[model samples]
Each structure stands twice: as structure tokens, then as C-alpha cells.
Target: MQKRLANFDLDLALNVTESTLGILGGSGAGKSMLLRCLAGMESPSKGQIVLNGRVLFDAKSGINVPSRDRRIGFLVQNYALFPHMTVAKNIAFGLPKALSARQVRQRVEAQLAAVQLQGYGDRYPIQLSGGQQQRVALARALASEPELLLLDEPFSALDTHLRSQMEQEMVTRLRTFNGVSLFVTHNLEEAYRVCQDLLVLEQGHAVAYGAKYDIFERPGLLGVAQLTGCKNISAAAEIAAQTVLAGDWGLPLQVVDSIPDRLAYVGIRAHQIRFTEHANQCNTVPCWLVSTSETPHRMTVFLKFNTQPDHPQDYHVQAEVFKEKWEMLKQKPLPWFVQLDPLRLMLLEA
Candidate 1:
């Protein structure tokens, strides 16, 4: 399907089956837009949307199902709950009007139990905490017994501790759900923890899509590498079958994987850089410390290779080390050797 906005145009086709697919991307990357289109909240400019063999949308045939009839549960960002309505009422609002009042009450109670917000249903949304409000919204979404669920940054408004707690709860909820789910978020760790598969979007385009491990381990494109938390990417050219020259770092790396013919970038995670005492280690680079940054439990050491001169951007690599290791390594002398493990190297296209 395709969606054309003023500055961004989303053009992509995807098929999802039974598993939860995480939509991962930065802000304005069309992550939310994709969920909106799938939920029938927005019409696609082209192509067709078929869910459970039902044609929800077909641009060529001029068929567009209304959002109400799509049977999609949408837990939007900020938990779009009715402020004046009680939790039970908010959940019951989504139930079919054909059902009797007693049936609506029963369904609402069941949804409340599913989200672990049973007795709290009598309270208004304003009286609940962020996490509780989120639970209420989830209950409302599932009240209609949707065939698909779309979650858009559902934990964006919660505190760190609460977010983590709710994430575990959400995992349990999704496990019991008998339908496919689409989770949209910019946070990589959250996506990794909650979804089995991933679809990475960049500038409204799907740069990569696959199993979570495969996407993280072998992100094939530069945009996907960045999204997967590859920090030390450099312009590269294939020098040999298994080697590539990392241009920005002025280092040639021997990678475990074959160098792609159209190689445009090489990357390694900051934590993958290993500090070693041996000078002759494979892929070792002797470097001088440029700076050290300390986080609560870790340290970021910036180093420049001996071959690189002292320029403003001469720091060739940033290595993340534990605080204990940093304390031990700081005791050593200058010209420390760091090894770039070939096994963890990421080769990418333009």
C-alpha cells in the first residue's frame, strides 16, 4: 500500500500471519501511519489490505471498510480514554450495540479481568495511574474481541519502572490473544523484548523486515544498522573477499562474513570492541585514549588509532566498557590495544 503526505510518502507491502510484528523506526518514519492504515483509520492511496482473507481495503475496486467494522483493536499513544467515563463504561462503549446490557456488562468484566483491572472499572480514567490507565485502554480495545491489535507506543508516557512492569504484563496479554498484533515503537530494546519479528522503517520506507534475531544480527542496510543500535559505522569499500577498508576510521578490517560487492558501510556495536593486552591479536588496533565518559554503570572510552592523526574527528572508535573494567584498564599505560571481533562486524549496503 501507499500513503502520500506532504513531505513523506509511505510505499510498502507486508504480510503478517500469527505472530506479533514489531514496527520499529524513529519519529516520523511512518510507524504509526502503517498501524493507522491497517486499522482502517486511514485509507491507503493504492493496493489492497486483506486480513483473515477478508478484503478490508482495495483501492482499485474502490472498496474501503469502515474502522468500526474492521475488528481491529487500537491502543494508541497516550491511551486515548474518555476522561468523563468510568473504566467499565469506556470498555463497554466498544461492545456491539446488538448485545443486551447484561451481555455488555459480562464482556466488560471479562476484559477487565484479562488486563487485571477488575474492580478498578468503577473509577474514572483521571483517577488511575499511567499504567492503570493504559490497562483500561487495553481492556477497551479488546472488549470488541478484535481479530487484530495495533499498539502505538503504548508505554511512551509511563515512567521507566512502570514501563518495564507493563511490558511484562503486555507480553502475557499478547500470549493469550488469539490474533495477530502490530506493535509500533521507536525503542529498540522494547521491540526486541515484546515482538517475535520486526519491520524497520526509514523515511517512510521499509528498510528491513525479518525475525528479531536475524534483523539485529545481520541488518543488511545502513539505515537498518543505525536503527539496530550499531554506533560505529564507517564508509567502506571491499578490499578483499573477507576484508573491507573502513574509511572514516582509516582501518582495514578482516570480517568473518564475506564482504559484499556493493559494500557501502561497516559497523560494530560499541560494546563489541574488546580491550586486549596482546599487540598481535587479530584485527587489533593500537590507540591512545582521547576521552572517557562515565555512565552510571558503564564507561565510554574514545580512542584514536596510531595511524590516524590528531584531528577534531580523529577518534576512531567508541568502546563501551563496564565500570569495573574501566577502573582496571585505567591503571594500565598508554597505547592500549583494542580488537574488533570479526564475528560481530556488520557489513551493510548503501
Candidate 2:
């Protein structure tokens, strides 16, 4: 499908079966636009959308299904719920009008129970907590038994604790859902934990798409490496069949596989940098600490090789170590030996 927005143009073709595909990207990368097109909120400039052998949209044939008739359930970023209606009414709002009142009531009750909000149907959305409000929104989306589910940053508005809790609930719910689900999020960890497959977007174009692990372990593009949380990347030029000069780091790296002909950059995850006692180790570099920063359970140690002059902004690599390891390493002297494992190195293109 292709969509041309004010400053962005999205051009990509995707095929999804009975699986949850996570859309990952930075701001303005068109993650939400893709969801909007699929949900019939926005029309694509061209191409066809066929779901379950039914044509949802076809530009060539001049066919476009209205949003209400698409059988798609969308959970927006804010969990858009009716302020005046009770939870039960919100869930029943999307039910088919042809159904009897008794049927509607039964479906509403079933959905309430499904989302674990059984007896709270009488309460308004404003009366519920953020997590509870999200549950109410989810119940409303599922009440009509949609064939396709699209979630646009559903957990973005929650607190850290609440986001974690809702993510677990969402994982459980998606497991039993019998339709294709498309989840949009800028959080890498959230995407990795919830979805089996991943589609990475950059500037409204798809840079990578495959199983989550495959994309994480071998992100083939510079933008993809950054999006996947690779902290260390350097301009590279092939020096030999299995070696490349990491220009920004002032180091030549040995890779496990033959260097790709189109290599533009090389990367390694922060946690993959190994500390070794011996300077004789292959791909080992003797380095001095530049500085350090800490999270709750992890510490980021910035370092530069002895080959480079001391400068505050010239720290070449940052290694993330567990707090326990950081405590031990801090007791050691200068000139720490770190190894860049060839197997863990990522060769990337522009």
C-alpha cells in the first residue's frame, strides 16, 4: 500500500496471517499511519487490502470499505471512551443494531467478564483508574468480535508500573485472539515482549521486517540498528575478507563472517562488550574509563582506547554492565581490557 501525507509518504507491502506484527519506529516514521490505513480511517493512494479473502480496499477497482463495515477493532493511544456513558454502554455501543436488547445485554456482560470488569459496568470511564480505563476500552473494542485488531501505542499514556502491568494483560489477551493484530509502538522492549514478528519503519519506509529475534540479532541497516537499541555504531570500510576498520572508534574489527560488499557501518550492543583480564585476547582493546552513568540495575561505562586522545566528547564506546559487575570492576585499576566478540558484531548498510 502507498499513502502520501503532508510531509511523509508511506510505501510498503505487507502480508500477515494469524500472528501479531509489531510496528516499530521513531517519531513521524508512519507507524500510526499504517494502522490508520488498515482500519479505514485513512485511504491509501494505491494498492489493495485483502483480509480473510475479502477485499477491504482496492484503488484500481474503486472499492473502499467504510470504517464501520470493516470489522476492525482499533484501540487508540488515549483509549477514547465516552465520558458520559457507563462502561456497559460503551461496550454495547458498537454491537450490531439488529440484535435484540437481551442479546446486547448478554454480549456486554460477556465482554465485561472477559476483560475482568464484570461488576464495574455501572461506573463511568472517569471513575476508573488509568489501567481500568484501558481495560474498559479493550472490552469495548472486543465486544463486536472484530476480525482485525489495531493498537496504536496503547500503553503510552500509562505510568511505568501501569504500563508493565497492562503489557502483560495485553500479551495474554492477544494469545487467545483469533485474528490478525497490528501493534504500533516506539518502545523497543515493549515491542520485543509482546509481538512475535517485527516491522521496522524509517521515514515512512520499511527498512526491515521479520521475526523479532532475527531483526534484533542482525539488523541490516544503520537506522534499524539504532532503533533496535544498538548503542555503538561506527563508519566502516572493509579492510580484508573478515575485517573492517571502525573509523569512528579508530579500531579494526574482526568479524565472524565475510564482510558484506555494501557495508556502511558496524555495530555492537552495549551489553555484548565483554571485559577480559588479558590484553592478548583476540579483538581486545586496552581502554581508559571516560565516565559512567547508572540506571536502577545497570551502569553505562563510557570508555576510549589509549590510541585516541582524551576528550570529553570522544568516548568511543559505551558498555552496559550489571550493577554487581560494575561494583567489582570499579575496584580494578586503569587500562581495562574489553573484547568485541566477532559473533556479536553487526554489519550494517546505510
Candidate 3:
């Protein structure tokens, strides 16, 4: 069974158990919706969500179990701490009271220690900094000892340096949980750095879901291509039928790949465009220098083109090179031959 999301269009129906799948997408891509659906925070209009051999939600089968029994620990965005409660109380909230006072105190103490907040137990949420408070949230979630963990934008609140630090800590701690961990984040770099597998979403659909390397190198679909930052995309026929790229540059490119005559998008990374010494013999073209910005370690050169037969806005190609390249050809505006690898030019279906 399946139903449409409020704003995004997706047909999310799958059984996730024991595998930690990282969902990376921009906001409102239904990543959190699916998680909430699974957790029973938001009921699905249709479809079924199963976790660890338990039937959580089923439309036609009519078997539904609420979130509590599903054994899912969710760390939502914004930490969601109890402002008035002490840190220890927040973590202890998840444990059963049937345990003696000694046992409860022992568990909370252990959790606080794990999150590096050993003695911050008596302090309320306001007394703790944002990072420390988030630690409390994470500690509380893990305190439940759930079989599945769902973290949504878990590190967005922290500063860059703190975020990196927490990620290392979380990965090491989560390793021993022995349960499925589904995490969602809009940060591509975070997804790359933290997740073992990636599920790239676009407009509420699973455009690409697989190993992280494959999605970055080849998105396997048009939506995924756009999301993965393929700037120089063009139809496949434009390559075979024509000898150049878009816009007016008319920069002649040799057709190396026997591409099928179909609507497709071809892309090359900005850094991939660079200069070569052999201007006469290389696959170079007559290009004029638009502008240059020199940084301590590198230089970015913008090339103004007369024509790029099929590109948008008469755009200038942005290329980055080492400071040495600028020094080697100092004080001279020169036309360099461009040698673009055919294999580097990815062709994805439009």
C-alpha cells in the first residue's frame, strides 16, 4: 500500500531492519516523513512499515503497532530537551521506574558519563550549552535501549568544529548498538563522512540509493544528477549530432563515447577544467580570460567565451588551479588548450 506525501511525491514502502541507511536530501524531501511514519508519530495514509520482523503498520493487513512497542529511539531535530528538568532526569525519563532508586541513578550516571557530561546531571537544560544539551538528547534516546535509532539532522545545531567532534563520538558509540540506525541530513559532506551507505532523495522520491561512491560518481538518474552538482549537463544527442557544448562558445569537443541518440545530460566538474601547456596539439580552444581571484593556496580563473552552443546564460567556465600554475605563466594573459577526458564527461538520461 502507498500514498502521496503532503508536498513531495514519493512511494516509500520498504522493510528496514538491522541496516543503518543514511538519508540525505534537502529540506522537505520526505526523509523525516518516512522516519516519522515508521515511528508512528505521523500515520501514513497508506503503506506499511515493518521493523525487525515486527509488523508496525500495514494498510490492507490492518495490523498496526504504536511507536512505543516498536522499540525505536528517535532523536529529532532541535534536541527537544526538557527545559526545566535536570540532565539526569531527562535521561532517566526513558527508564522504567520499577527499577530501584539505586538502579535508576546508576543508569543515568552511566549515560551522562558516556556523553561526556559526567557531573552535569543536576543542571537544567538552560544551564547547559547547546552542544551539551544535544548530548543529553542523544543520551536520552540511547537510554531507552531501542532496537532501532532514528536521528534527524542530529548535528545541524552545533558549530562546524563541534559537529565534527560529536560525529566521531557518535559513530564509535553507535557501533555497539547492534540495531538499524536510519539518519537524515541535508549536509552532503556529513553524509559522505559519516554514513556507510547513502539514500539520495529528490522531490520526495528515491532517486538513488546505494553505496556513497556510486551515487557521487554516477547518480543513475536525472534528478540525482542535478542534486549531485553536475553543472555542465547537456543532452546526449547534443554530443553526437554536434561537435560542441551549449552556449555560444562553439568550443569544439570530439565525440569519444558512442552515446545513444537520446535526451540526456552530460556534466563535468568545475575543478576538472584546467589548463595545459600544449595549446596547439591538445583538445584546446581559443578562450579569453574573464577574471581571476588569487588565494593563498590556489587561483580561480574564469574564462569568458564567445559561444558555448548549448549552455545557459552565456555562462563563464570556472576553473581552479594551483598557485604554481599561475606563477609559471605569470604576467601574461594566455590561451591554454583544454584536454577533457571523455570518461570524465558523465552522461545521464534526461
Candidate 4:
């Protein structure tokens, strides 16, 4: 699917199988726009969107399905519920118009029970809690037995505690839904917890899309690395088949396999840094302690390379450790040797 806007450009080409797939990107990166295109709420410049072997959108064919007839459940941010309608009426609204009054009531009851809101069906949206209102919205979406589900930051507006609860509830609720579900979220932890596959978008392009584990383990691009929470990235040049000189870290990193021929950058997660006393270890370097910050459960330690202080552009590397490790390290010294694991290192392209 592709769309061109005044400020953003979207170019995505991929197939989504039956599973919960995550669309991860920063704000205005075309996450919601793509969802709208899929829902037939927004037309793409030119592309085809097929669902369950049905052609939903084909520019060349001039076939565009209406949003109401697409049989897709779109759960947007803020729940998108009708404030004036009771929970039962809200859910019943999704029922097909052809259904009889008795059938609509039966279906609404079933949806309420499915979402564990049997007794709250008479309450209005204003009377319900944030989590309950979200459930009502979800129930309405699911009431029609949609062939596909599109969630656009469905839990983003909830409080931190409620958001976590809703995330778990959604996962459980969607387990029985045997269709494709696209979950758009910028929070990596939310995506990691709720999605089976990942689609990483950058500047409206599909930078990386694959199984969740594969995308996390081997993010091939620099943008993907940054999106995956890799705080330490350095310029690099391939010195040999299995080694590359990391210019920012001031070390030559050796990997288990041969490095890419045109490797342009290297990335390591902050938590991947290992403290060691031996300076002779492979890929170990002594760094001057810059500063440290303490959180409730972990510590963020900042360090700079032992290189001369003349290079102000050289950024400090952030290393994270649990409080227990911080306790042991704090008792010892200021200068420490940090080892970069060969297996954990990521060689990336620009």
C-alpha cells in the first residue's frame, strides 16, 4: 500500500498472514494513515488491498469497498464509543441491519458476555471507567464478526496502570479471533508483548518487517536499530571479513560470522554491556566514567571512551545494569572495562 501526503510519503508492500502484527513507528510516520487506507476510510494514491481473498481496494480495477461493508473492526484511540448510547446499544449498532430485533438483542448480549460486561450493558459510556469503555468499543467492533481487526493506539489514552491491564485483556480477548489483526503502537514494550510479527516503518517506508524475534535480533538498518531501543550506535568500516573497526567506540569488533561487505554502522543495546576487570578480553576497552543515574530497579551509567577529550563530537555510551550489579560496581572503582559481546553486536547499514 502507498500514499503521498503533503508532509509524508508512504510506500509499503508486504503480505500479512493470520496473526497479530505490529506496526511500530514514531508519530506522523503514517501508522494511522495506513490503517485508514486499509479500512477504506482513506484512499491510497494507487494500490491493492485484499482481505480474505476479497479485493478491498484496487486502483486499477476501480474497486473500493465501503468502510461499513469491509467487515473490518477499527478500534481507534479514545475508544471511539458513542457517548450518548448505552453499552448495549453501542454493541448492537455493529449488528447487521438485516438482523431481526430479537437477533440483534441476542447478539448484543453475547458480545457483552464475551467482554465480561454482562451487567454493565445498561450503563452509558460516561458512567464506565476507561478500561470498561474500551471494552465496550472492542465489543462493538467484534460484534459484527469482522474478518480483520485494526487497532490504532487503542490503549494509548489510558493511565499507565490501566493501560497495562488493558493490554493483557486485549491479548486474551483477541486470542479467539482467528483473523488478521494490525496493532499500531510506538511503544516497543507494548508491541513486544502483544504482537507475534512486527512491521517497522520509518518516514512512511517499510524499513523492516518480519517475525518479531528476527526483526529484534537482526535489525538490518540504522533506523530500525534506533527504533528497537539500541542506544549505542557507532560508525564502522569493515576491516576484514569477520571484523569491523567501530569508530565511535574506538574498538575493532570481531563477530561470529563474516561482517557485511558494506557495513556502515554498529549497534549494541545498553543492557548488553558487560563489566569486566580484565582489559585483555576480546572487544574490551577501558572507558572513563562520565556520570550515573539511579532508578528504583536499575541504574543508567554513562561512560566515554579513553580517547582524547579534544573530540567533543564523540558521544558517550550509556550502559544499564540492575541495582544488584550497580551495588557491586559502585564499591569498586571509577574507571572500568566494558566488554561488547560478539554475539550481541549488530552490524547495520545506513
- Top model number, lDDT: 2
> Which prediction has the highest TM-score against the true structure?
2
The TM-score obtained by model 2 is 0.98
Across 1-350, the per-residue lDDT of candidate 3 in tens digits comes to: 34477675567644455666789776777888778877778777777777666778887888778776777788988988888898999998877657788988998888888899998999999998878888899899888778888999999899978898888888877777789888898777777777778887767677788878888776756667666665555543464343445333445455454454553555566567756666664346555566677888888766655433243334456567788877875556555556555656565666
Can you tell me which runs of candidate 1 are displaced by over 4 Å?
Answer: 307-313
The best-first sequence of candidates by lDDT reads: 2, 1, 4, 3
Per-residue lDDT value at 111 in model 3: 88
The digit string of per-residue lDDT tens for model 2 on 160-252 reads 999999999999999999999999998989999999999999888999999999999999889999999999999999998799999998899
Candidate with the larger TM-score of 1 and 2: 2
The local distance difference test score of model 4 is: 0.88
Candidate 4 versus the native: TM-score? 0.95
Q: For model 4, what is the error of residue 40's alpha carbon versus the real structure, in angstroms, after optimal superposition?
A: 1.2
lDDT of every model, 2 decimals = 0.90, 0.92, 0.72, 0.88
- TM-score: model 1 vs. ground truth: 0.96
- Ranked candidates, highest TM-score first: 2, 1, 4, 3
TM-score of each: 0.96, 0.98, 0.84, 0.95
Candidate 3 weakest lDDT stretch, 10 residues: 306-315
Backbone clashes under 3 angstroms, per model: 0, 0, 15, 0
Poorest stretch of ten by lDDT in candidate 2 = 305-314
Segments of candidate 4 deviating more than 4 angstroms: 307-315
In model 3, where do residues sit more than 4 Å from their true spots? 1-3, 15-19, 96-100, 235-261, 280-286, 291-301, 305-314, 320-332
